[model samples]
Target chain A: MTGKLAWTKIALPLGVAALLLLAWDAAVRVSGSDIFPRPHEVLRGIIQLIEQGLLLKYVVASLFRVTWGFTLAVLIGVPFGLFLGWYGWAFQAFNPMIQMLRPISPIAWIPVAILWFKVTDKAPIFLIFLASVFPIAVSAIAAVQNMQPVYLRAARNFGLTQLQLFRRVILPATLPQIITGIRIALGVAWLVVVAAEMIAVNSGLGYLIIDARNAGKRYDLVVAGMVMIGLIGLVLDLLVRQLEKFDEVRWGYANR
Target chain B: MQANPTVQVRDLWMSFPGKRSGEQVHVLERINFEVRQGEFVCIVGPSGCGKSTLLNIIGGFLRGSRGDVMVEGQPVAGPDPRRIFVFQENGVFPWLTVTENIGFGLLKKSEPERAKIVAHYIEMVGLNGFERAYPRELSGGMKQRVEIARALAANPDIIYMDEPFGALDFITRLKMRADLVRIWQSEKKTILFVTHDIEEAVQLSDRVLVMSKRPATIQTIVSIDLPRPRDLDSAGYLETRDRIFSAMGMSLRIGENEKEALPISAQQPV
Candidate 1:
């Protein structure tokens, strides 16, 4: 029974996807449109890109920018957030500016990124970094602020120094929330990289879509790029979710 | 009075600022008490009578507005490793397993020593099979046991409990009380426990301190002269329990009229 239930969990989603593809094919055939590509055509386009090695190259390029941008965001954002969360005066001084900047779209930073980095890889990388850092920092700050007072009391009763308290209690207690923030920031980073590449860079999935359309109206390749982006985003989310399985952080999540 | 006092509170007063400016809300008043070495003392009072606040003050989590709390002859300036507090709420670190939580304060010890101590406490708490289970996986009573074990493993001279079993079910609380008595007998740690349950106070402590309502003061201190494995239905137990109930101005018998039983505010229309 368990095996059957598991099979249905996977099979049901795949079945819906198959139905959607068939509907798309029917719509195209019934309309008799020449410009729009069929599902098979998109599949063929992906296979063609694979043969030409552009699929791997473009994927690697997009991933490379996202990796660097997201890494930088985590490294800088977490510690800055911890500081803000720890010191009341520091939060007071910096919070208004963070709140003010947070709501503005990361896409709004595209112009500044281009002006600063001049159409290089850094432009898109900077935009991805901009998109991701705020959520990560804000989540960390909230996590620290919302920590249980009993834990702090317990730590103090143990005679832990301030630094030891942070290392042992504060960090571990807040980590589950921080990991959630990292997951959200990664999604935003993936989104911003695609947007950034469409405007500023020359060789990623986003660029492939724009280039395919402008060069020869290759809608098949465009659709394939979108599919690849969706697949990769799902993969990235899955990877980050694995962090929640750790024994030290599992309590933060609800049991299945 | 045979043993030296392990804890002393001299004229402790606590007050917090009221919502209105220049106004103070007195929570505790002239709180004076002492727990002799290896004695189990329980503080019983009405809800919001500031019994927990008094415990916190002595535990060094909060400061009294006036007076001093001395433990083992040293004034409590702040929380010390030698005195551990088991909170009313679940205080076990959710992120840590039973073993890790029990070993939390043993960070200074050698790895082997810490492991041995953690293992011993885990066994003592009857959590032998759950050594690797996180607190979230345990029931309320089990989690409280983990907390008690954690406090004992630290080798604290005194354990301050603020209604530690208040959250457990009746059966679980009874079992916990029995197990706690067993542990206290073996460990011989001086304990100061606060609870609103008169029966519980009578069951666990060598002395029970009853407190008055807000701006609270120790109204009376009744010493329990019963032996270990006390019989709850015994005439002596009932008599002592009745005395505490009367001291708190409560009657065991329900009033004949329901309306007369309730306060005026509770009698008002919704």
Candidate 2:
């Protein structure tokens, strides 16, 4: 019965997608214009890119930028967040700057990033890092702030030392929330990577879209790039969602 | 020299500075008590009467503004592992399974030793089949049991519990009280439990410390001489329960400051 339900769940979305594709095909054919690519044209464009080896290159480039930027963000953001959450004075001193910078868009950083990094690989990577870090840090801080007071008291009463307390209680207690923060930041990072690539870098999925349109108006390749981006983003989100299912972190998701 | 009480609070006074300048709110006032080794003591008071504050002071989680709390002749400088506290059911760590939660304090021990101790407490708490379950999977009663087991696994001679079963439903509370009594009898740990439930105090404690309103004082200490598995409907039980009620001014038409001893037989359903 569960298997049947799962199959239905898969079939339903596939059916909708197929219908959308059919409508797009009919619309393009009726217009009698080749400006807008049909569904099969987009598929053919993808196959052409694969044969040319550019699809894998562009995908690898985008993934590489995202992985580095997101990794650096996590490494810096978690500790910075824990520090701010642990120390009140530090939060008070720097919170205004963090809050001020958080609202600015990664796209807004494009001009500054290019000037700072001189159109190198570092510019888009910097933009992605900047875009993702604050959300990760803010979520980590919230995670620590939202901790139940009883856990700390219980930990201290159990004779945990300063180091032991953080390692045993604070770290484990905050991990589920931190993972959630990282997941959110990963989404933001992926978004920033594409936008950053559109202006700052010359080779990525985002670049592929602009290049396809501007180079020769290859609308089919442009549509193919969009499809790939959506599919990849969905897969990335699913992978992070798996982290929330871990036994130790499962409690956070239980009530929800 | 007489051995120091298993737990002692000497002229304890705890207050915190109020939000307004030069203002203070007295949480506990001139509280004094001692629990002999292997005794089960419960402190009972009306809601917001500072009973929990008094327990925190004795447990070394809070410092008294003007007094001393000594356990085994050593003054409480800070929270110590030798005196573990069991909080409300929420005290059990949600991140840990039953075995891990129980073995938390025992982590410094050897693996085999920690396993044995964790297994023992899990069995003692009647959570034998659920050792691998996290606290989210447990009912309120079961979570409290895990908290209690966690405290026991620490091997603390004195366990301070703050409203440990207050969140449980009526039937669960009753069962927990009985389970606690059985555990106490077998373990022989000195327990200091704070609660607002007089019936629970009467059923489980060796002595009940009745406290007054805010800036609370230990108004009276009522000892229960009844046998184990106390009959809740018996006249003796009802009388003791009503006496505590009357002492707390919850008896029919009794004022909050009423001090006059009342005849137990005169008690009616409040």
Candidate 3:
């Protein structure tokens, strides 16, 4: 019953989007503009990219960079976040360093990433990691610092050991915040991937964009690549939303 | 020296490190109190007083800078399952169902025993039909009953509640007060409850310990001396309630004051 109530609101918008897709295809055919290719042509372009193995390589390259960078960032960022959130001294130690450098873009890090890592794949990964790390660190810290002290008390009273408290109560309690950080960090990850790929990497959707623009072969292909990036991003966001929903069900708003 | 209470608090002191300034600020001092076996001691004071702090110290949720609290004549160094606590904000874990929460303490018991205990408390709290219901689905009074049942299922000798009903509306709060009194009288568990409301302290407790402002010292402790199933309209209830308020630096203006004592009765409905 509750599920029906939640899903009922989606019916109208979904129908509208389906209707718009039909309208867009018809309008493109009727206009007869060389520039306004049909949506089917874009769909065929997507299939051609896939069949030529070009799309796969770029997708693989982008995924590899994103996955490794995100993993490393989590490895480095979570500890920093947990530490910062746990104590006053941790923040005092890292705040100035993090804040001073935080505002600098991931694109800015591209030159440094290339210089520091010397143009290897590590360079782009490093930039992506840099982009993703801070939000996770900051949010993790915020989550832990803001945690309602009640959960701690509840845990202690329930025979949770110090380790158990951190694992069960503290870690789980900070997860919603950590998830928020991860979600925000994902945007940075995607942004860094495009920028990093454009300058340093030999292949990726970013590379495809720049390469196509230089060739002037098809702006639609460039748009197609951009759309694919956006579509993947939407999936990532939805994945995070689902995870956060599960966490919220397990705890209440993660309280901090 | 007073035959050590089931729960004894001696000269408990706690102070806060003032935020932003790192200044030392005393919150409670010179606090001496005890809760005998099955005793109901209510502590009341003005807002900012350390009533909750004192309760937390006794519960071992917070450490007191001075003195100690003994439960069963053993110094309480940390939280113990044998001593349960119910707080004003929802203490029931949101993830757990009514049955799961009531059975929270029964984890130490054998599986069958745990089930039996859970079943008993569900019936006792009149929550049998709603065993699988999550706390978010229940009304406030129902949630409080589950906590009360949860504590009872643990068979804890004492319950340290810090304004368990303070968040509820007046009607709900009144109903909860009645239900709590009924539960306490039947179970006869020691309860050290903290509140800022004098009437609540008076209606529910055998004794009310009123604390002064921050660096809170126990200004006074009033034994309600009112009988079970206390009549809200009776003179004895009004007198005790007024005394607690006057100690709290306010007199009752909303409710009429009484000067005559009503017949006291110990008979309680099952």
Index of the highest-TM-score prediction:
1
What is the full ranking by DockQ, best candidate first?
1, 2, 3
Rank by lDDT (best first): 1, 2, 3
Task: Write out the backbone clash pairs for model 3.
Answer: A143-A256, B27-B215, B27-B216
Q: List runs of model 3 lying over 4 Å from the truth.
A: A1-44, A115-121, A247-256, B1-4, B11-29, B62-69, B103-113, B212-219, B243-250, B253-270
Q: After TM-score superposition, what is the CA distance of residue A198 in candidate 1 from its true location, in Å? A: 0.8
List clashing residue pairs in candidate 2: none
Quote the positional error of residue A173 for candidate 2 in Å.
1.0
What lDDT is obtained when candidate 1 is compared to the true structure?
0.94
**Model 1, B1-270: lDDT tens per residue?**
448988999999999999999999999999888899999999999999999999999999899999999988889998989999999987899988998899999999999999999999988989989998988889999999999999999999899999999999999999999999999999989999999999999999999999998999999999999987999999999999999998988878885443226776768797
lDDT, residue B270, candidate 3: 47
Q: Give the top-scoring candidate (lDDT).
A: 1
Expressed as tens digits, the lDDT of each residue in B153-238 for candidate 2 is 99898999999988989999988988999999998888999999898899999899999988899999999998777998899888
For model 2 the TM-score comes to 0.93
In model 3, the number of clashes is 3
Q: Please, what are the lDDT tens digits per residue for candidate 1 over residues A1-256?
A: 9999999999999999999999999999999998899999999999999999999999999999999999999999999998999899999999999999999998888899989999899999888888899999999999999999899999999999899999999999999999999999999999989889898999999999999999999999999999999999999999999998998998888863
